[model samples]
Target: MDNIDRKMLEILQEDSRITIIDLAKKLNLSRPSVNERFRRLQEKGIIEGFTARISHEKIGKGTLVIIQIGNLKVVCHKFEEIVKEEKAILECHRVTGSDSYFMKAVVSSTKELEELVDRLVPYGQLNTSVVLSSPVSNRTLLPEDEFLHKN
Candidate 1:
């Protein structure tokens, strides 16, 4: 993608609901040009479907937990199938290294966390960590990222 395409992505990340006219103004391009680029971006699959960010705390899922599941060299799909049905699981990824899989989940209380742990115990050995606080999280991505820069 060109600089203009990159800029469009950066702007869209901030506010997906922005109108084509407003986006055109921000990018200093004509409405037709911006519209075409936006359409092309979607067609290319670079811009995935839009989604709303739900607040875990407000939704009664205040506790965030990271889970590492190991020793599932065979029958990985069995574990995957179970987690897919869990509403608490936000992300589950297959990773390289000592861990077979990594997952992020949210719970309302420790009781709920324990219940979740109980259900998954049969699949593999799990190493779970409860998050006390997240100083940096859910940051936007860019083609050229300056992750540490405020501006």
Candidate 2:
């Protein structure tokens, strides 16, 4: 993608709520031009979708666990189906290396985490890590200024 596409992405990442007019003003471009760029970005699948990043802690999701799944070759198809039913499981991945799959789950308490563990046990040999704290988490890809300078 070019510099303008990168800049639009940067602005959206910071705040999805920013009005198209405001975005145009900030970028010093016409409203229609800004809208067109955004449209093209969406069409090219560069801009996937917008969503709010909610805090798990504020919503009573106090437990965070990273589960490593083994023996995925046996039940690859069923694994996706199983994880879909679970609300606590926020992220799932088919990873490389020793483990076949890695999943991040959030629960209300330790007991809930244990229950989540038990629920996953039947799938394969499970190794879980309870998260203590998150030092830095940058969900945003690139800032507008950074993207401009890089290009």
Candidate 3:
């Protein structure tokens, strides 16, 4: 992808709901060209899909727990098959050291957390840490510091 494509991607990543006309204006390109580029990007699988970010607190799932999973081998192949049916697991990652995998789970109460841990035991050993509060969770993936970083 060229610089223009990357710029378009950056804009879209910030807010996917922006209109075609607005996007064209922002990128200083003709509407037809912008539309065509978007279509091509989609066709090439560069623009996979669009989705909304939902707040867990608003959805009545305020509790966040970081679960460290251990004693499991062959995670890449089997992990998906195992977790496909589970709904509470929001995110999972294979990690280094004593922890084989790190998982993010959303629960309503402490009892539910216990139950969730119980369910995960068959898959691997679980060490859960409840998030008391998050002062900041910077969800941005783009490099915002290149221009802003003073140092």
Worst 10 residues of 1 by lDDT: 142-151
lDDT of 3 by residue, 71-136 (tens): 865465686677656688898887899888888888888888888887778877779999898886
Error of 1 at 41 (Å): 0.8
For all candidates in order, the CA lDDT equals 0.89, 0.85, 0.81
What lDDT score is found at residue 101 in candidate 2?
88
Instruction: Please give the lDDT score for candidate 1.
Output: 0.89
The C-alpha TM-scores of every prediction are 0.91, 0.89, 0.79
lDDT of 2 by residue, 8-127 (tens): 788898999999999998888999999999998799677889988888999999777899998764577788889889999999999898888899999999989989988888888899
Return the candidate ranking by lDDT, descending: 1, 2, 3
29-148 per-residue lDDT for model 1 (tens digits): 999999999999899888997888888999899999999999874487877888899988999999999988999999999999999998887788899999999998867777654532
Write down the worst ten-residue block by lDDT for model 2. Answer: 142-151
lDDT agreement of model 2 with the native: 0.85
Deviation in Å, model 1, residue 55 alpha carbon: 0.9
lDDT of 1 at 22: 98
Better of 1 and 3 by TM-score: 1
Better of 1 and 2 by TM-score: 1
Q: Model 2: which residue pairs collide?
A: none
